[model samples]
Target: MAAAIERLLSEISESEDPLEELRSLRTAVSETPLSGLRESFSAPQLRVIFSLLNTNDKEQVEVCVDVLERVLQVLDPTHLVQNCKSELQSGLNHPDDSVKVLALSQIGRVVSHAEGTIEVLNNPEILQDVIQSIGAERISVSKEAIATLLKLSNTKAGLDGLFHSDLLKDLKDVMAISDVIRYRVYELVVELSLVSPVCLEYCANSRFISQLLEELTGDDVLIRATAIEMVTNLAQSQHGRQYLAQQGIMDKISNMIIAADSDSFSSFYLPGLVKFFGNLAIMDSPQQVCESYPAFLNTVFNMALNPDPSLTPVALDTLGLLGGTVEGKQVLHKTGDQFKSVLKRMSQLARDGATDLRVRSLEAITQLLVLPVEQQTDDLLLLTESWFASLSSQPMEMIKHISTQPFPELHCCALRIYTAIACQEWAQRLMMSTPGFTEWVVDRSVGKGKEAKDCKFELVGALLSSPSTREIFGAQNYLKLKTYLQEGPYYVSAVSSVTTEGAD
Candidate 1:
């Protein structure tokens, strides 16, 4: 393999065309790890290959950058970067935008661990070069440049260094040039915000905030959504939210979305608009939240009925949160037609043939029950009939199926709902009539600990925890069931306790 790699390196060095040489090297590296190939090349030969990154021919430079990216795999990236700094600087200065982006791309890879990489950490200009690339004329160049900056910002040195530079102005310069670059840069800004309080403060620049607010109502759908999301990320911090509210962004959005004329602006983007305010309302004072979202619930309700599967889940989540608030509950009660329709929609979704969607719909219904009246009223019959009525008029078979669900949360949640209904007098008779309910509780509850896949202990625990349902199980085997429950985790909680991170 050493001799074969040496032969390939010799062929690469002698090739008349650098692109052709890179092509041969790419194939060799793919078949043999670059580690294996690096040992065969003498130091001088490696420099010759690395020097191709400085080639003024843009296409060959791209190919060569691709080669350097692979070489860094087996070679010491920090060492190679320092050794080839002059060439990389030349690549950065190349007039062709592609070479500049590719150079920044490589720099991004090299400075990835800024704590240890003296070439970038010790040098301020290397970080400046990355920031300057953000203002490149071409979008691709700036996009890669932003990605480069994102990688740098993740490092401790990068964090300490980026917050100190005139990064805000350079990022604003990119945002001013193109909406495409604007959002991409904002994503990097959000990352930088996570690292430092000063960076988050810079992101609150008045001019930048004004532009983001203006873009919130822009003619373009993509631009509007981008603006909303940037605001969302910033809202993650309390100071960030205070800055946003000081700008009156929350009120501006509330007025704009509530305006009858704003439908054209928001119809396609209702999900984003709903989410923007939903997030805002959650973060603000309860009195302010109560006064702010009176008109938006109908739009969210409509989203529940919209056939777009992806939108439906987020919309349902928003609705569930809305229903939890004091004002949102009143809104649901005031608009019973809309409220029941949503319940009916959730019920239908719970019964859908798709298991995953069924799980989501069931969970959403559980969130709705946070509003006590909704649960005590129509939602009660609707959910029970949707999840349980299919197997029997009761929950015995329904609870059994739930206990065996692949996801433990589903078992925990569905049974919690089933438990609510089971405490009712009629539900007791339903449990008494079902044979599978007894078998699952007694066999799994008191039987040996647990098995490979199936678990029903959470369900068993739920049943025994309740006085009404416990009576239905009869008192003869009470002590045995009690002893089994006392043992470590029942199957359901036991399975839930297992963390699968890094498992085979």
Candidate 2:
């Protein structure tokens, strides 16, 4: 094994195809036991592998990094920091972004240990190198550098090293590079803030959150769009939400939505703004958000009617998210005629719009209509039933026709819609009243693919699980439906004994 390692190293230095040599070394190092690797691999030999990162070939650099990660796993962490530290630091300072990424990755691996974290954090030059790499021209290098910094932040010593020193100042300098890089740093800040309230406090103190919030109302619509997304991410946590609310960021966003109606370039940032409020609604109380910001619901309904392809889907998705909760459903239901118009539009889009629009519209309808057994109140049920009725004169037949389409995604989505409503008494009555609908439910071959089959099984399970099934379908049909559920989604009879099959 030692001789083989020597031969591969020699080939890597001499061979015209060093990538092949690197690949061979990667496989060798991965398969060999740690003991065998330690006996054969020396520190100088690993440095030689590290030198491969200087190469122009991206694939070769990747293979070299891969081999080093495996070999480094077996080596003592102290030895790596003591011996290989300079080599990795050079890689980080290397002019080539690929080399920098390779180095950042190795440092990331090292910093996963307590001692390695302390060592890297103590070295100002190496630490600065990693932070500056966040602004690298190549996104891959920037991403790796950000990942390394995130790993460092995971450890107490490393976290203090970052937040206690000129870390924020360095990050602020990096943000001056470009809007693209700025958002990358913002992403890191948002991620770190989510770690704990203490980490969030560090982020807030750094003024990074303030800078991010300012970007929302900034002149650049694209930046405003980008900024809102990060702000939305920060709002995901309880403390973060409290912080943003304290700043009146929600109300400010509400004002932006109202102002968007007159802005010609609103399309650029409008979707993100709607999504922020949508997520905010779902995260907090839907009733509270909608009641607090009537413009949010109003804009969503308007965007749904808008012909701009980009805006409509966002609006549909936001609607779906808002309707996922009981409060959200009630909020929409209370919109009355305004909500009815939106439902009418959604029904049309579900049948005749683009594939994505159709799917999203169906999903929104399902979220609005489906009620969990626990949350099923008389008022909510009536609201869902009314929404379903308002969808079309024959909502069931339209969805059934959609299920017949060849696309498996549409088929599965349609089945999910049925499953969502299968337990409702009004839905059950409609199924019984509709021609061949009950037979369609029990038909094993009605849908194709594993997902569609699973969805069909769920629908049957929902029906059988419902209290009204025995009374609604009668004992005979109820037994047949129950047997279908028991047989499972993928069940098939060995003998083909179909009395009749429904039309595709």
Candidate 3:
């Protein structure tokens, strides 16, 4: 193909009938497989091809243009951009208006992909041509040019060139032009702002943020959703947050959440809304977080307290995600007796016949109990004692049902909570009642086995912490665990004798 095209170019450059030779070459180039053709053509071949493409023969020029685009990946990849620019400028001057527009759009793509392309794009002459192409009355040409500009704006250097080349204000013009290009422009704003925070800082005081925020209330769901997402990113930055908060966006979003309307849950706004509030919790100070806690907690608590069980789990999980903080814990404390009421309610739900509700109820109870002792009172001890006594008499079948359920998170929570309570006496009572329970715990704790290990590690931890339980663990019933502790992992034996002799 390269030899054939070279022969044809030579023939066309010298023939008495150049047009005929150009026509024949156009046909051959059109028939050539684009992939194989690019591999064959050198940079010189492309320059000669571009030279012939600018000829008066429109069909020859058009075919060359089509083939040129398909072969772009195989081109110099960066150099010889000036040749394409000159040819495009010549094509733009053609008598045929469609030919002119095609030339302009093609020029944009070439420049967009060109290495060292920024120099050409930033030139006042080329910048004017790009803007003129975008504003052309021919909708197809104008749309193509605008789309190309938006894509070009995605690159850091390209965006920087635009900012320096009067392209920024020109982008605002394209953004104001409606239709599909509007979304493209909106996305460009987001990309542009995200890529360069310095650009965003500069644009922060501009009308762009206001324009985008106003779109949040637009009737179009996509626009609202995009606006929410944009606000989310913008608000995450300290500058963005300061800007939105000054605009009263914080109050507006809170009210929107409270309203709980259809628009808030629409495809575009829902994730944005959740992210917005979630980010708010992250952004606020502990004091500020505490101040807003009651409103958030009451809203979630009422939803959890509702008669329909379906919303309870979703609301519980959402609330957990939202209030996962010390300040949130403070909110729970401030709710006073209401907090106690919710705990009792969870206990009731845990006792309910529905397994799913019981699981969620158990989780909520675990969350409340996992807090520090300073955060709770002895009232919870009575509650646990009641549940423990009930479990002690329950059938083995019932115990299996509780233990076999595959909630590892719940199991870990149970381990931590139960360990917190398992003083030596309580542990002895547990072992006596369950028989081989310490062995079960040890097997699970230490082995590849599903059960726990029986070691003095558990008993020692329990005994040292609870004075009464220590006295009970000193007796014969716990002798095996006591022996294991003397022989095992903690080297409790290595320290125990010296400590015991001192005490003696």
Candidate with top TM-score is 2
Runs with alpha carbons beyond 4 Å of true place in candidate 2: 1-24, 34-40, 52-63, 76-78, 95-98, 496-504
Which order, best to worst by lDDT?
2, 1, 3
Q: What is the C-alpha RMSD of each candidate to the true structure, in Å?
A: 9.8, 4.3, 14.0
Better of 1 and 2 by lDDT: 2
Worst 10 residues of 3 by lDDT: 447-456
Q: Summarize candidate 3's per-residue lDDT along 1-504 as a digit string, tens digits.
A: 667777887876566546666666666677777766666666665666566655676776666666555555455534545545665566555555565566666656655674635656645565555655554556666666656565566566765676655766776776666645555555545544654566565455445667777876777776776677777777666766776788888777666556554443443454455556656665765346436633445545665666666446654554444334445545555666665555555555655536677666555443433333343335444443443444334422233344444654334333433454455233346544665555554342332223223322553454444545445544553565455555654332233444555574
Better of 1 and 2 by TM-score: 2
Q: lDDT per prediction?
A: 0.62, 0.86, 0.55
lDDT tens readout by residue for model 2, 1-504? 667777898888777668887888888777778878876777887888887777678788778778876787777766787788889888888776666876788788778888888888778678888999988888899899889988888877887888788875787888898888899999999998988888888888888889899989999888888998999899899888898989999889999999998999999998888888888888889999899999999999998988888899998998888888888888888888998998899999999999989999999888888887778888888988998888889889988999999988889888888888888888889999999999998998888889889888888888887898899998989989989988888998897655656745
352-417 per-residue lDDT for model 1 (tens digits): 525666667666655544323334445444543343344334435544565456655556556555
TM-score of each: 0.61, 0.91, 0.48
- Among these predicted structures, which one has the highest lDDT? 2
Which pairs of residues collide in candidate 1?
none
Clashes of 2: 0
Stretches off by above 4 angstroms in model 3 are 1-117, 123-160, 163-197, 219-226, 258-275, 290-294, 306-314, 339-403, 406-504
